[model samples]
Target: MSFQEISPADTAESLRNGNAVLIDVREPHEYGAERIHGALLYPMSTFDPRALPIDSSRDVILHCGSAKRSGMALMRCAEAGVPINKHLAGGIMLWKREGLPTIKVDPATGRVFDPQQG
Candidate 1:
């Protein structure tokens, strides 16, 4: 089954409008390092598409550091008969390249990173 892919900017817009749910399929450490604000953690290593909450009212968008894992997650969903709304075309890398806002947490100190200070 074919799946839909959305651009990072469009995904960000959908998220801002509360019309989509962004699921990050990367590992916890990766997520903690940097991630799109408000994205839900669903690591691909231990992901169960069947366990994903189904909300007909909103779109479900899956993503990872790159598109590889997210693409695999989409296949898993399809195999499980779960209907995914869409996925980020190029994942978080693309999102960051687009200059979309993200939340960065320091794993050691649990402090938030200031983008401007970087």
Candidate 2:
């Protein structure tokens, strides 16, 4: 079975509840530049569920620069037995657009982005 898709807020909430997995499909370089708090590195182009931490019973959420790639990855992972409960609607760009928390990765020093509070 395939996984369910939801908004970034729901996904983030799932993560906060400690019951979901967040997989960023972007490459290491891109991921290093910016990523969600608990998201892991699993580029869809090169990831094989049989190799990574994928388990059919667990919740898995895939993401990319845009929802396009993540959607594709979600389908593929679902076909590969990634569990029907897993959630994946899109990428982090939209999540940021929603005003959710995000970390910007710096290429030079590899620092995370944090706009200080006023």
lDDT by residue (tens digit), candidate 1, 32-96? 88988888999988999988867999899999987989999999999888998478998999898
User: TM-scores across all candidates?
Assistant: 0.90, 0.78
RMSD for each model, in Å, please? 2.6, 3.2
How many backbone collisions does model 1 have? 0
User: What's the lDDT for all of these models?
Assistant: 0.89, 0.72
lDDT per residue, candidate 2, 11-100, as tens digits? 888888877778887888888777788888888669776555655555667778777777776677667775434445656878888888
